[model samples]
Target: MRIAIVDYGMGNLHSVTKAFEHVAGDDASIVLTDDPIEVAAADKVVFPGQGAMPDCMRHLEESGLKGAVLDAARQKPFLGICVGAQLLFDYSEEGDTPGLGVFAGEVVRFPKERMHDEAGHKLKVPHMGWNEMFIAREHPLWQGISQGERFYFVHSYHFKPSDDIAVIESAYPYRFAAAVAKDNIFAIQCHPEKSHNAGLQLLRNFVHWDGRP
Candidate 1:
């Protein structure tokens, strides 16, 4: 299989590429490119990104790969990480930026005012570090992974899908969609590349998934 990692200029492409390389082995050919044609031709697509939403959207547009990314998402197995995942939504409150609108929802910031845990300890805005995820629904991506597996996260905003059925919830102090899955698309807020064993396993599953739910 051929796998393409969309390089729209706003992501830590190295780590994501390396992780896929480690897991994919000889089973697939991986390419990281900003070219839309290359992205659209791939059998699978890994959309990984960091930084702010507005900048990500701007770079995606500037790179001329926006339509390509959307096309790949619709045509094949697509895995979106971090901001890449956030960009699939309708809009973001982070700078009031509009997103790709692949899914009907908005990305909202973690409440700055209610930034406290149950113990009354101050919680940070960027919900960094390792956190456990509660798998809201079963799908091909969760293969061989158990519920409550921990994944590394580093983002201030969270995706709130309009359809709750698509949500794979997680928590900092409260619940939010840690992952979302629709037909042919699976997205996550955590960095599977940085999540060690569980993360690598997730990537491996993606490599083998047939783009089904």
Candidate 2:
């Protein structure tokens, strides 16, 4: 099997590539490339990104991989991480940018004004560190992962799908879409590559998944 990690020049590409290597080992052909043809030829596609939405969109557009990504999301077993997840939505509040629109949703900021916990303690905007993920829907990707597993996260914006059923909610102070799955596409706000065992398990699941909904 072949797996391609989209290299849009915005994310920690090496770390993600290494994590996939650890899981797939020598059984799968894993490559990190910006070439649309390489992405289109893969069995699975992983789109990972970090940084602002505007910059991510810009790089995706300029790198000439945008159509390839959309096609992969529609045709293959696709996994999107962090800003990659946000970019799947219709639009984003960040820089008022638009996304790939693979799903009907909008990405919004974590409300700087209300960045406080229940006890009124100041909460960080990035929402860094490990956070609990409450699985909202059953999917093959969540095969071995528990319902309330914690995953590493580092983001200021979160996706809000118009269809509530598409969301796997997580709480910072309030609930937000921590992950989303529909058809052949599965996306998460967390950095699974950096989340240790659980993360690796998810990657393994993706490798074995047959792109079924």
**Candidate that scores best on TM-score:** 1
Locate the minimum summed-lDDT window of 10 residues in model 1.
163-172
Q: What TM value does model 2 have?
A: 0.96
lDDT of 2 by residue, 131-160 (tens): 888877788888899888889989888988
Best by lDDT: 1
For model 2, the stretches where C-alpha displacement exceeds 4 angstroms are 165-167
TM-scores, all models, native as reference: 0.97, 0.96
Q: Residue 117: error of model 2 in Å?
A: 1.7
- What is each predicted model's overall lDDT from 0 to 1? 0.91, 0.91
Backbone clashes under 3 angstroms, per model: 0, 0
Give Cα distance to truth, residue 90, candidate 2, Å. Answer: 0.6
| Per-residue lDDT value at 189 in model 2 | 88
